[model samples]
Target: MKPQVILFDLDDTLTESKQKVSDEMAQVFSRLLENNKAAIVSGAKFEQQLNQFINFLPKDSNLKNFFSFPQNATECMTFDGKIWAKEYSFSLSNEEITEITNALNKVLEETKIIENEISYGERIENRGAQITFSALGQEAPVSAKKTWDPDQIKRRDLQKRLEEIIPQYEIVIGGMTSIDITKKGINKTKAVNWLSEKLDLPVSSMLYIGDSLFPGGNDAIVIQTGIPVMETKNPKQTTGIIDSFLKENVV
Candidate 1:
């Protein structure tokens, strides 16, 4: 079915695999904004995600053009402050945060995760309420990342163990050997669901495009609700999807 509203995944999708959102994607975003039906539903936090694409946007434009549906916080509008079009954020307790941090650090420190020169970023990001345990330390090479965790079994196991230590928190595998820990009842799928209901739309009427849609992958949970899914690969493909969606539907 054609969707009424379309959601986006920033990283490997609109941006290249390297997570760089190019000028081409920026133009596509401007087009989507003109249509007023595009939103970014990504794993990155609002502040961090906005930092990536905000420069490409016009200075006078409102920040609501993009949406950052992080696992821990309610969806944050790109330019808008914390409370945006809607609120579905979940904050972690101090004790829960400390406990998970210690456990994740211990596991990553003890194991040798794949690291490649193409890799960029960090091994750990305590995004305030959420903690990301990255095997590649956020700097593993692209080629190495593709082979780092093909089966996802290892990461899944890590999630299970982490959950055991802090059952109250939400644990899920994410981008290239990274595990995102959030407060209970928080997940990408949940964030989308919350947004859909608040916007008075149906689940089936939305499509989420993300690179992490594979099983045990961070965005996999959204597939459970039967929302349309798109595998994020090239930025051009994301542009094509958005253009196609616009051509097929009026909004």
Candidate 2:
């Protein structure tokens, strides 16, 4: 049976990290919404989603059929034509945010990996319910970000240290050069389950596509939910995956 909804990871999977979605992907996305519901789940904040993908969607695309899971699924937004409204959002208290910040500082100080690295924009951002540590800065060029941690060795070590220091929070490697810290149990799987319940579809009727499904990758959590998954290397391959899906199932 065809999937009731298609869930996608934004960075790497749908487009280059922090890059706008291609015109080709936009057309394919609009076509996708013609027959099925679709959702974008990313570690990015809502504005990133807006600039990178949502803004490029076809004008006539059915807005109601789309969902946005930003901030590592800590927040969910749905389009209501005029604007995107919060379906739900989880927030951290001031004290919790402070603790997370302090923990990150302690980890960085102890690890000393990122301390000497040159950064781009803001490195640590508190996105309401989640705090992100973008190693090279959020606006760093994709080339720089890719080179920063190709083997994932650097980030995996960072994540391990973070987990030890901030055991209360869920920490995961995100995007190319970022670490996501969210409240416990809040990850990509949370978004997938929420969509399953809201759309009244079983996990078996859903498919998740992402670039990072390997162990410890941000998108890896969805694997625990028993949803079908496809791994794509980049946006070009993602377009091909969508095209094939449309051919096989859109009729």
Candidate 3:
């Protein structure tokens, strides 16, 4: 069945980790937006989303049909033809940020995983609504990020430790080398539910595609929303999925 809207996860599903959207992907994705409503939900900040994905799209693309749920959907942004506006945001308090960051630091010290590694940038970032810990640092190369945690064992271990330290916030593994934390109940599921109400469509009318749908993965939370999902391992697989969507007479 054709969906009223299609939702996507950004990092590995739509593009490489922390990389810009490809020309071919932008073309196909723009085509998809012409007739279908689409949304990108990621743990990335709004600036990263624009720099990595939104900036690559053709200017003529249908911005009205596109939505961005950055910071693990703790914030939502939509285009208003002339400008992108925030529909809603759930920002963290300064106290909450401090607590989360402190917990992250404690866990990192206990694990000592960073002792021998070369970090690219800030290891922990306060993204307003969400705090993210990128194991190899925020600006780590894609090759390094991919090779650092192919099995997610290291991140899962870290996530376990962080959860124990800060039990009030939501923590999940995302991308290749990042752990994202948000307020309890603030997640991709909330984003989809918000969009469903905004569009006056049922949750079942949307389709989600992502790379991390396994248990404990960030994308796994959306499964609770009962939206149909297609899992892809990488951007290439995601492109093929988009191609199939284009072949369908979806409107």
Best by lDDT: 3
Pick by lDDT: 2 or 3, better one: 3
Candidate 1 local lDDT, 129-204, one digit each (tens): 6888777666567677778777887787777677666787788777666788876766767656766776788888
TM-score of 1: 0.82
> What global local distance difference test value does model 3 have?
0.91
How big is the positional error of residue 215 in model 1, measured in Å on the Cα after superposition?
2.1
My TM-score estimates for the predictions, one after another, are 0.82, 0.96, 0.95
Candidate closer to the true structure by lDDT (higher is better), 1 or 2: 2
- Quality of model 1 by C-alpha lDDT: 0.68
Superposed on all Cα atoms, the candidates' RMSDs to the truth, in angstroms, are: 3.6, 1.3, 1.5
TM-score, predicted candidate 2 vs. hidden true structure? 0.96
Root mean square deviation (Cα) for candidate 1: 3.6
Better of 1 and 3 by TM-score: 3
